[model samples]
Target chain A: MRNILLTISYLGTRYHGFQVQKNAVTVAQTLQDAMEILLGRREDIKGCSRTDAGVHAGFYCLNFKTENPMPLPRIQRGLNGLLPWDISVRGCREVPEDFHARYDVLGKRYRYLIWNSPARSPFWEGRAYSYYPPLDLEKARAVCRAYVGSHDFSAFCSVKSDVEDRVRTVTHCGIEREGDLVTFTVEGDGFLYHMVRIMVGTMFWVNEGRLSVEEIPAIIASRDRGRAGKTAPACGLYLDRVFYDLEGLRWEEGKDLG
Target chain B: MADLENIEHLRKKRARIGFLKKALALLLIVAAIALAVAFRHEISRLNLVEQLTSHLVGIGSGPGWPVDISGITVREMAPMGNDLAVLTDTDLIFYSAQGREIRRVQHGCANPVMKVGGTRVLLYDTGSREIRVESKTRTVGSKTMEYAVDTGDISANNCVVLVTQGARYASEVTVLDKNLAQLYQWRSADSRVMVAALSDQQDEMAVGTVNVRDGQLYSTLLLFRFDEEQEYVREELAGELIHSLRYKQGCLQALSSRRLLTFSETGKRMAEYSLGEETLTAFDSGAELFTTLLVGDYREFKELDLAIVDYTGAAVGGSQLDFQVEDSTAAGDRVVLQSGGTLYLYGGGALLDEMAPLMEILDIQLVGKNLYLLTPSTLEKITVR
Candidate 1:
């Protein structure tokens, strides 16, 4: 048997989420169906992370063990041919038989997009979150900086999650603006349920002057979820990249950010 | 042999389950595609029930709808006889006065200009020489002019008047009857014809021409008879270009940049109202009893003044509005002024009602109490009451 790693991207507008469910269509189930058609048998897939409904993935990692001797390129092309247009297999590679797709992940990056315009864009429907008020990037940048380093992010995680240990180290955090699109990017070793969305939502409050920029650290230390802002919508959240190497995806301070 | 048969039967049963699963997946895909097409607008927002209701009822389509005009460029919209006509670059669509889509006709005009006359409409391409005249249901006739069309109009009787570049002169006015037969043709000598109109009575045609003389612009209003060799009545105004000219009840009403002047059929000035220094922003002479005008102090319309004047150049109703007027139209005795998403309705020289619509109002047309509003995406009808 050979263990394979796959990097994939998908537009999650029409999907329920990354996890498979009995009644709902999900990314995992779709991939399993496509792989069954291509390899003539079912293969269990392990995803690196679970995304909410309407949350997209620009780059995601997954792994599956198969006894069939298939080339990486053929597996990619064959899976792409059977999968829907919105979901695509970006790259494939061989891994050790004992390698795990989820447990071995070093860090991951997430990006949230905001269309900061009064008028809605037709092309960006279902792809971005539309915010009418003008965003103050300087204040939002300060909020992003306050989120760097390590802290218990219980204030930012959703209350529905039952995880006891919520402490995580955030490696990189920044915000960039290009024309009408505002991008908020954060890299962390792991994320709790809806943690990135909550951080972005709190940043939005700071931008609108509803919350002070200096209060972000206090909110994190308080560990009270009610102290933070509301969770930002899932449509604007995207799993941007998954890093297997610690030194490869670390962001240098004051460096050019996309 | 019996053991081999048992294994083969089990293999066949497992293969049957796989085939059934594949078939079920295909069926789900087809059903999903069907649902997406049926509820495209609502599916974008994931409001499936509202979409089903919109499809089933066809009324009360929520404040967000009448279909999003994301990719459509609406050129012009006007009120047909009893329906509303919206002309885009690719299609001419008609809707009932109740705001239900009635019919549509495909058109091929690159730079389309639409002129509505009664139940018929004239679609002309300024980039090309093609003109198509269509009724509410189907196209009546189509014609190709010798030169590029400059501007055109259609009379209530369906008589078409087109101003095109003349081969031997500056411009020409060509009139065609309802059947598209050439009724009258005249070529200008030196002036460029800015506007042309056929009288409601259909016995006369009027042309407004502008030319520069002695370093100043001069405009002339000429009325012609079909049987006459030359213009029957000619009137000239110096330094003012005529914007619109129409005939109402034997009086020829001409609106220029600075004034509204009315003249008799024999070219005698009747009653004139000077606008002084105020800039005329918009005017509509579609109504028979009154014409509505919106004026502002500067071209950048901040606060506007609305003037409703009768054909005899008398003010029926007028008011200074605090908001800028985007568009205004008059029909019967009512005038509707659209400012942003709000509409101010006036009837009998009094402010009747002020309404704030859910969608943005791009243009408006008023007929009695039924006001047709054109938004970026949909055509809506609202009653003044």
Candidate 2:
């Protein structure tokens, strides 16, 4: 059996989240089911991260051992055929036996979409969140700039979440607005549960004039969830991409890809 | 003399002790005051009385819901029991009551649209020319269209109707089953096929066409059946553009922008009503009743009105909304009109209640007995009264 790496995209609207839990359905389980049906055997899938439910992903990574020597084209088409319409496997490749989808990760990018229009479209029904009140875009951006660089994101994550360390390096966290669509993109080495959502929710509070941008340092120092804004909806959050040192996003018709 | 000497010695000792004690007390007091000033912020943090009072001043509660999933690019939603079928740009997701996705399928479709028909779902991708028929969690069957289909709809009885047009001259109509297999096909040889409607049983179909007679354009509706191979009824609608050809509640409704004409299933003219000469923006329907939002200039008058019209082409009741509605959805016995951040829920054509203002609401949908509010960040569920 050969270990394989797959790039994936999914609409999180119907998922319990990216990770599998008891009783609840997940994206990973769905992919595993499709893999089993395609290869006619069970394949243990290891996902890069445990994205919460309703969080979309433009690019995510996972690995599985496939005894079936299905070619790249066949695997892509076959798994896609067996999979549901909401989840898609973009590409697949054979990686080194020791290559891991999670451990060797260099960074990951996440994005959240905000519909700033007062009027919402039925087309955007489940896709983007609508923010009606006029927000201070300039100040909201300033708050985003403050999050750039490495820091302890203790207060930015779920208080109930117990991680050994809350220290994460945020290489980029910025906000951009095009018409009424507001996008928040962040690049980091790792994230805590609900960290991105809380960052966004708190940024909104800053824009709403409820919280000051200067209070962010104290909130981080406080390491308290109460100091941050509301956790933004999972619908607006998306796993944008995962980066490895060399593999990046290239998985062409090559002999080996990791 | 010895007593006097002892008294003097005692006085000297007492004076020296007093001076030393005073200096020590002053130094200690100064040190204590310096420490308090230096750690004032830290001391304030320990003030439990202030902390409780500050908690009281804090607004309601904060948002930290451990929500599982969020929705996106939702093209359409079909509420099923405690679940919802959401059609995104390229996929179909079936979500449980708690917003957990039970199943998902990637259609790789372009310009996708989904409709819930009876117990089956019809997912069509106009760009890919593909139609996938899904029942619950499984895709039962799928087929590809030869041409890019424009207007298509499915019935609860598992009938699919599609209108494909290459140009104004090249047009065709096809009817299919839940498997997306073509059961009936018709290509317009003389007139351009504008729109088509399928019956609930998948046994009957209606096609609307536009043909020229003596240089005058004429609109017509024809009834057909596969076994009969005959045009049961060919009703000519003069000068009226049949915008929508739908069979609702045992009647054929051919509605244009300004008029609605009803016909019997057997192709007999029943009744007709002239809507105000205005642009009909949106039309929402229930099991038996339908209403249209007419904006822009209405005849000579200009305002927004919700005209409730029945299948017999008669106006049930017309009410002018008090506010400019951004969007609205009506289902069962409830009609919700959203203006800005507030929602006005109406029952029996009268205002019932108003939802509190939200930060931003993109859309509001009535699912079963619950209210689904689409915000900028989440889809919140609220109980219906």
Candidate 3:
């Protein structure tokens, strides 16, 4: 059997997210069903991470073992043709037999979009969250800086998460503002369930003047979900990318690989 | 017999080496092809840039103009001249073609007022409940004449011909001579006037009224001639709940919850276009007879969608632009919309240009054929030739 890695993107407005649930439509279920139909076998497909409902994915990774002799290109083309319009398989490639999609992931990045306007938008109704109140930019930036470092992050994680290790290192976090639009981008070693959303919610409170930047440390220390801001809506959050080390992959000397 | 055996073994070894070489070469070739395919998207993006650069227009070598005012928002542009008036959060600024601020009218209210006009300036101060009119030309040494009316505009010379509020929403059609004196105040029969519009020639105005019954908003439109004795005529239009109304040329455009209705300035409904499930937020009429609709969240701290529709109630081709708010100022009036570090220009159903990223774009305006974008650092002029 040959292991194949696939890069995918999807608009997550319609599905329950990247994982499969009982009688619920999901990105993984659709991809798995399509693979089964094309290969005539039910092979377990593993995703790098799980994104919540209404959260988009620009670049997600998945892997599965197939015994069929069909080439990687054919599998990619077949899966793309069968997938829905909202989901797309960007690429497919053969990988080492030991390669796994989830455990091999080195880090992940996420972005949260905020539409800061006094008016509602019809076009971006499902795409972004609209915040119409005046926001304090400096306070939001300060709070974003506070999130950059290693911390338990227990207070930021959701109550329903089963993971026991809440300690995660945030490598980078920044906030940028364009005309009436603000985005929070964060890269970390790993994130707990609803961690990014809750962090964004805390930042929103900082922008709203209800919470101060100095209070972030206390919220992190509290280790209680109630101490943090309300969890941000799911629609505005997106899994931007997943990074992996390429030590084993071989490449041509003068050829650019990106 | 020993030499023959050695020769046979050497031949087998040579064949094995050849096969290994061929396999190595094949692996190298596959790796090269994969790398090329992986970078194909980046190469295509470069090609797009090259194509766009061939059609790019360079910025003119002009000196920077001084813009001292803050909270400035462009209101309307003049068709014949290079005149554009902007409403600041507190004051109104009029600019000449040379980028000189000619007039600045101050409104004492803390909240910003919405301004409307082509050559003449009408300021609607909702806080003070007053309407002020000023001519483009300096008639009284930069001092604008102000009027205090009892009710807001239910309709006026613009698409709103009457101004009314509360149960006794009184609408008065006042005609002024060149000196800004009230020539006549014509009152309407209805107590509440919700929407209004004025003709291009300033000779006629249409008024719409709303009466809420059983938690439903019902509306009516009326047209009046602005003469010595104001003549009133009621015309029937098929629509409900006029939320926004604007008059350009002789066409009266009213935005209802269901569709956009177009009527003659004389109150004749010409055509209707449905807006589907899209809600109307902010509406601005252009100088060249087009209207811009900023539809999104109407409350505080919400994102908005923008669309431009022409006079005939048709969506302007290539006029849909999306922007996201990244951060907001302390006052909440000035918001930063993320444009992905690029500037987009739209006019007449076409995207004019995607200019290089300037500072942050704060506000946009279509003045005559020139599109003016006020960035945080510069005022960019995009000429649609």
- The TM-scores of all predictions, comma-separated, are 0.49, 0.46, 0.42
Q: For residues B1-385, what per-residue lDDT tens digits would candidate 2 score against the true structure? A: 9999999999999999999999999999999889978887665434333333323323233342222235456566666444566677767876555555566888677678776665456777765567777755467787777777776777756678887875544677888865566788777767777778777646788888887888767887788876676678887876666677777776777776557778776778888767643456666653345544334322112135666567776666666653557777766445677877788776656678888764577666675556666665666667665
User: What is the per-residue lDDT of model 3 for residues B283-365, given as tens digits with 9 covering 90 to 100?
Assistant: 55543356655554322112355555677666654243334323211000111123546645444434545555556666655
State the lDDT of candidate 3 residue by residue for A195-244, as single tens digits.
Answer: 99889888887777767889999999888776777677788988877877
What ranking emerges by TM-score with the best candidate at the front?
Answer: 1, 2, 3
The best candidate by DockQ is 3
**Ten residues in a row with the worst lDDT in model 1 chain B?**
B56-65
Q: Write the per-residue lDDT of candidate 1 for residues B1-385, one digit (tens) a residue.
A: 9999999999999999999999999999999999879888655433344334323433332443243456777877776655567888899987655556666888887778899875578998875788999875567889999998999999866788999987788998999987789989999979999999888666788899999988989999898988886898888888888999887776778999988988777667888888865678888888776777777642221246778888777887877664566677788668777777788887745788889988777777775667766676666667775
Which residues of candidate 1, in runs, are more than 4 Å off?
A1-258, B1-71, B298-302
Poorest lDDT segment (10 consecutive residues) of candidate 3 chain A: A248-257
- Model 1's DockQ score: 0.00
- DockQ of every candidate: 0.00, 0.01, 0.01
CA lDDT, every prediction?
Answer: 0.81, 0.72, 0.64
Which portions of model 2 miss their true places by more than 4 Å? A1-258, B1-71, B80-83, B97-100, B166-169, B210-218, B286-302
Give per-residue lDDT, candidate 3, residue B337.
24
Better of 1 and 3 by TM-score: 1
RMSD of 2: 35.3
The docking category that best describes candidate 2 is incorrect
Estimate, for each residue in A1-258, the C-alpha lDDT of model 2 and write its tens digit: 788999999999888888776557889889878888888887888888888778889888888887787898899999899889999989888888887888867777788889888898677666777777766778888888788777888888775677878899887777888888888888788888888888888888888777899998788778776677777767888888787754545322211234
